[model samples]
Target chain A: MSVEVEVNENDLAEMVEQVWESYLDPEGINPLIPTYDENQPSEVHSSVSISGSWTGHIVYACSIEAARRAAAAFLAMEPDEVSQEDLSDVLGELANIVGGNVKAMLPPGAFLSLPQVVLAPESTARFPNTERISGVYGIWDGEPVSISMWHSRADNNQEDGA
Target chain B: MTLSQPEFAFVSTLVRKEASIVLAPGKEYLVEARLIPVARAVGAANVNEFLAELQRRPNPAHQRKIIDALTTNETSWFRDREPFAALTDVILPELIKSRATTRKVRFWSGASSSGQEAYSLAITLQEALPSGWNYEIVGTDISTEMVKRAETAEYSQVEVNRGLPASQLVQYFERAGAHWRVTSQLRKNVSFKLMNLTAPLPAMQPFDVIFMRNVLIYFDVATKRTVLQNVAKLLRPDGWLFLGAAETTIGIDDNYERVAAGRTSAYRVRTGVPAGASRRG
Candidate 1:
């Protein structure tokens, strides 16, 4: 059965902090005081699904520049040398790491999907049957980044029964 | 660059059929990006042009290159730091004691990319077991290039920095110009092979421990079931199976039971017909 515990923005903020410190930039990661502006551009997006006892989606949205920088750090290459594939790969992995940690916090037995990276400019992701549970905004080297969780409505209905 | 719907569907079908890896719809960027180099290698101007060529005549060599490029994974020594802890603290000690009569132990690093995992097992077992113990470490992956790299036992500076600590790096590796090669001692007990997890495996001895970390996430339910069935055959009755921390055997296979060791856990094949041991969909 899915764990009915609520995941708030602060929880997501903490998770993002740990991931960035461990994998990306330690010194540059900080929680943004306020959530990102709706108008802020999100040039690249990455996501992963967690299925099993609990089914949900974890999404990471960042500007192209931010993604390129993250990819450079992950691949240990210069920013100029980072290809679109490198960007997608690194961002996808970042989402995978965060998604895996988020799953760990939930009910056990939930399985993570391989990350999916979307490269369209100024794009956002939404699931029809899921509602936003938490959304955290942060800045990495002055670029806006966001992480959000969505829980399937079916899981919520089952929670009501429990 | 984003992949068009037709292109996304095309690569998705090909990747799934070829590797049993599900590339969902939104991963269009990955499909295009992964294929771009393959496109360039074959002298195509762009991904569209390359797709056109692939459509005209699906070259096996180009297909292999595409699969290899798309199959890349990020790994490091002691990744997640839990399974290794479970290994040294719980699994290894138990195996060594139980196998004292044979003085022999074997490990299978399923989906071992670039050999870090197989070598990690060798590193831990080197100190955990007695000097004269017979230990075998076999690493396998579907990518032929990764198999070759694993055979070489070489890693770049970036890879070494990922999860390897400074002390172990210096202790277990020697400089090989631009890269570091696993010490002869570390590579001595390890072997690499090319094996696709989705397909049936060849004849092999039962293993005492299997590191099936991080790969099953890409497989569908039936593939996961098939892989687990095969693993049941390969693993001895008392053997340990370590999956990625995010993965579990709950719904996919019912023959295994979770065994906790501190913060991490190991799964053991249930013996004696467990109460709810019947496999379920």
Candidate 2:
């Protein structure tokens, strides 16, 4: 099965919108143009992997300023009081929620892995032999947040795409 | 715009009387968070005004809405994976054998919010049970809105995401516009009812498995004990009971003896003793 055809950017956008509306702020997220601005790499990046019917990763990234405000809103705290660990957790949960919805669109039996968070000044997290198949770029509470789906090329070669 | 102490107290008392859910002092944020939308929906100026209006008029339907608002339906499919894993790995095998003569098993999703837990049980049994075997699931919630939502079996994208495995989503649910609707196969044997656990339970058949997960935290010790006792009345002698991870019958009820079921714990009615016989003495 072509992973790109099965799950695409529009599916990712809807999942992101749902997570934002349910947890963070209702109707606060709006889809951005489907283009990446590599000059402003997100300070924090979080991702969760899917294994089984499809193998890949869903990554969420956002600026540090945005992360603090989002974390505060999620934890019901003031933005200044949000900690580094809180930012990591909130981003990880966002990735997990988006990942889970995306996983549902895939073939049956896809297992979602625990969320992994990266706190860095740049987009440093990498997945070897994986290609980005689909992505959704959106703005939430004025912060640029994006979710991307990566399909593992190694898994593609190794397993029969049953 | 903020929920004041009196408004909070009023809501807490109303909810306690209506649904037996205790809204403690610090949960002002919870009340505010859950009720702001309710306030907006009803065209109240704010949560404070909503409470004022509720007290002034004393409308049963509006009071029911307040109770429903306070009682959070925070549930997901196969929430807390170990319990479901245990059902497949340990409990079902035993129940299948014990009920071999009848070839039927019944389940109760006690405190089933929006029917995820109940549907989860249906999916579990559908996959695990042998051919020619039959099953039934009855889900109950105090909130009329939730019961209706559960009966509909239509869930939003976010609702379906939580704790639901992808394979089951593909197998059991079909897309209805933007939302996902649980397929007829999963809904056929399952039904939801508007019943309060703290109140006298409606007449129902004894169930082989009863899941009262993640709901006891909202009650005080006495209410918990009473609810557990009431639940015990409907559970078969050899049936299984799954409470939330943090909840237990150890101090509250003596009739239940805990049994380790796979990675989680399940309670069984102690053999060699009459049902509801307290072992505390």
- Could you list the CA RMSD of all candidates, in the order they appear? 19.9, 9.7
Q: DockQ for every model, please.
A: 0.01, 0.09
Q: Name the regions of candidate 2 deviating beyond 4 angstroms.
A: A1-162, B4-33, B38-46, B49-73, B277-281
In terms of lDDT, model 1 sits at: 0.77
Best TM-score among the predictions, by candidate number: 2
Return the TM-scores of chain A for each candidate in numbered order.
0.82, 0.83
TM-score of the B chain in each candidate versus the native B chain: 0.78, 0.80
Off by over 4 Å in 1: A1-162, B5-31, B38-73, B273-281
Accuracy of chain B in candidate 2 (TM-score): 0.80
Query: Per-residue lDDT for B67-172 in model 2, tens only?
Result: 6666544566788888899999998999889999999999999888788889999999999999999999999987787899999999887788788889988899
**Candidate-wise lDDT, in order:** 0.77, 0.80
